[model samples]
Target: MSEFERIGPEPARLLMEQGATVVDIRDPHSFANGHITGAQHLDNNTLTAFVAGADRDQPLIVCCYHGNSSQPAAAYLADQGFARVFSLDGGYELWRQQFPEQIAQPDPHK
Candidate 1:
């Protein structure tokens, strides 16, 4: 089984600059409220395609409410053949606190 890396918000930001695909695993309601600027919200419904269609070589960063949940999810993703996967340390809330500008505004239409 493959394992994922755990990284702090700052390192996660660096990976984004390096072209990581950030995926938020929080519920849709929470995700719609706020998320990383370039993140894509994902859940059970979207996970299959997201994994199957994803570029295995591309880096992936998983985020959740707190740092806890993302570890298992990231490990699962990596096990699914994702070569490089990471779970954000301190998760989205911490990210929002430390990097307000990086948090994306909610879409009014959603």
Candidate 2:
């Protein structure tokens, strides 16, 4: 019955500043290619385990290539008892477009 909140880039950045764990739910290869600085990588499938080890009380922000992948991932985290699970509203692509300096560029090979 819990719902995940969608947060914009500014708020997401604020959350990160306040010690929230920003998780990149993209695949390992994609993650390695590029991701938010300090983001923990956990592909969507392994989200549950990742949450188990993380601090549930702290805010958790999930992001993917375009936000699609993060929706269900955030929902799943919310269902798993995470009090504050949030999905990046526009994902990395938007972040890149909006804040180029903050966005990590994908690897050329990828």
Candidate 3:
């Protein structure tokens, strides 16, 4: 059984460097405002497709506004067969504070 674990920003970054897939559970607006670089936004409507197409062998990291919502989402992803699942501790808020340069904002011209 795959199990999800809680991880802080630093370790999460390290995992990302090792090719982990990162998903943000925040709403579209918040996700557009700022998110971890390379993060894919996943909501109810998009989750099924994501799960179906995702590479289960790669590490998956789930993030929410404050690290609370990601826990369940991470667990759910793990159950779906992701080998290494992580609920980002402190979530996007903490990640933003700790690694501001890693944040990606929508293009103003768009």
Candidate 4:
């Protein structure tokens, strides 16, 4: 298993409040459905370009539907020199359950 710091919704919220950049790694379709507020949708496909322009100095919080995808994504960001990178413990699902107000609701028209 890969070593990762699993953060709960409260801590995640604090991180975001403190200027952490939340990166959602789910597919664009799923992202358009819903995601955390202010999260940047990079998806698995556009990671390279996203990282190129991303601020390495900023704290990065990565998330996915269940947390599986965000692990490697967070690791990749770390490898790319991001100072602080984290994966949401249980991904957006747990986040939604813990902080309903923070989760972005899906748009019906998509």
lDDT, each prediction: 0.93, 0.84, 0.95, 0.84
Q: For model 2, state the Cα shift of residue 99 in Å.
A: 2.6
Residue pairs with colliding backbones in model 4 are none
Per-residue alpha-carbon lDDT of model 4 for 14-91, expressed as tens digits?
A: 999999999898878788777899998986577788888888888889998888888887887888888888988889
Ranking by TM-score: 3, 1, 4, 2
RMSD of each: 1.3, 2.7, 1.1, 2.3
What would the per-residue lDDT of candidate 2 be over residues 1-110, giving only the tens digit for each residue?
Answer: 57889998899999988999888877788777777877888864776678678788999999998988899888988888888999998898787677777756565775
As a whole number from 0 to 100, the lDDT of residue 97 in candidate 2 is 76
Higher-scoring candidate on TM-score, 1 or 3: 3
Which regions in candidate 1 have their CA more than 4 angstroms from the true location?
Answer: 108-110
Q: Could you tell me which residue pairs clash in candidate 1?
A: none
lDDT of 1 at 71: 90
Model 3: per-residue Cα lDDT over 1-110, one tens digit each: 45789999999999999999999999999999999999999999999999999999999999999999999899889889888999999999999999999999889999
How many Å off is the CA of 6 in candidate 1?
Answer: 0.6
Question: Best candidate, TM-score-wise?
Answer: 3
Candidate 3's displacement at residue 19, Å, is 0.1
* Better by lDDT, candidate 2 or 1: 1
| 10 residues in a row with least lDDT, candidate 1 | 101-110
Model 4 residue runs over 4 Å out of place are 1-4, 107-110
Candidate 2 residue runs with Cα over 4 Å from true position: 44-48, 104-110
Q: How far is candidate 1 from the true structure (C-alpha RMSD, Å)?
A: 1.3
Write the residue-wise lDDT of candidate 1 on 25-49 in tens digits.
Answer: 9999899888999999889999999
Model 2: colliding residue pairs: none
